[model samples]
Target: MRLNNSKKAKFFYFLSSLILMTLFLGAAFFVLEQYRFYILGWKSVLLIIIPALLALIFIFSGRQIFEYDSDGEALNFRNRNVLTFFNKPVRDEFPKYKLLQYEFVNILIFKRLYITISSKKNNLIILKYDVSYLTGKELKDLKFSLSKVIKANQEREKNS
Candidate 1:
């Protein structure tokens, strides 16, 4: 199940990004116009370029990547950004023997269903759990779906 933050969260992101974009781009334009007035010479180019580029990147990085297996056997996700070029994608294969744990986390104005897996392994949470935003119904459905798959995996593990 692909979940996303509420509309309010998205709107907040948009408004903030829009303001930053306007401010940075406007300043960049003003600085570029004052090319000859620069005492710092090449340093002026870096100053104008950095914030303008950051603003553009800020807008782009808001995009999220989500991928779940058809059978709910695995999930992978990541943020769409320049860092993604270096960062490996987060992937979790619903492990058979590991016990799953979950809770409701309240961060600022948001409520989220947080889940983690426990096992003999040293990893605290075997899956790189990105906070996927889900509505009440979606959360319920995810819980149900996970329970089913986990049970099936456990049975298979037991048989083996």
Candidate 2:
């Protein structure tokens, strides 16, 4: 049974990437037709082929490597099949507190010391060991929620 309610996870970059890929494909075709002889050379092939292959990968899969589980018994997860490259878990510390809500953002639990991409749901995408994930807006939303949770914790502490 799923604990967190599923909602449409916003991947803001999807449209931009689609547009970019479309443009690149158009340009590549145009180049092939207009400058066909020039593009056949090694240098042109290297410049266009590598990025095109990468773009195709991105277009098909999207960019994500981890999933977020705020309510799970285990607060963090690393895929066993994935080769460990960072030499450290993404979060700065093991997340403490019941995670109420999370959007695409950078999460810093006080105890842990590695950065992590906040997961939205099961199948969308999960980013792992990714330092460059999260946007400014997502970060702001997360900070606001975290501040509220911290304040509530402080109040409970004082009362007890």
Candidate 3:
């Protein structure tokens, strides 16, 4: 199964970026008109460059999709960094046979789920979002599916 960012999450992201863009444009206008600033020096260049980069980041993130994919045998996850053109995806994959276990957990009072892919490696964490509660249900469903995969694999091995 695949899980993508929810509509409400995307709406919040879009709205937040829209507000930030408006603020940056407003600041640029104020600096140019009220103070008669020009992008001629390092300081002026910084003012223009920094806000522009920040605006771009906000816009890019707003357009981004956080996706999670899992099958019986392997799990893959990555962010579709939408504005990053020509960027190759760095997909993280964990095979079922190596999976140890999983649990809903908290550390330092932060709530999240962790799936142990291997004892030698760090657990794959379900990323948290304050605006979304759907992840909890999804992760549990994924865990259920993965368990079935492991059991089936074991049965096939025994019958062989």
Identify the candidate with maximal TM-score. Answer: 3
Ranking by TM-score: 3, 1, 2
- To one decimal, what is the Cα RMSD in angstroms of model 3 from the true structure? 8.0
**Residue lDDT tens for model 2, 1-160:** 1111112123424543564576587567657755765554545545456666555544333223333343433455332112233233344224434333333333342111133323445223333333123344544444564456556656765899
lDDT (Cα atoms) of all candidates against the true structure: 0.51, 0.40, 0.54
Model 2 lDDT on a 0 to 1 scale:
0.40
Error at 23, model 2, angstroms: 10
Model 1 TM-score, 2 decimals: 0.43
- Greater lDDT among 1 and 2 belongs to 1
Which prediction has more favorable TM-score, 2 or 3?
Answer: 3
lDDT of 3 at 60: 39
Candidates ranked by lDDT: 3, 1, 2
Candidate 1 residues 81-108, lDDT tens each? Answer: 2234434545455543454555655454
TM-score of each: 0.43, 0.34, 0.44
Q: Stretches of candidate 3 above 4 Å error?
A: 6-20, 32-64, 85-89, 101-115, 119-160
Per-candidate Cα RMSD to the true structure, in Å, reads 7.9, 11.0, 8.0
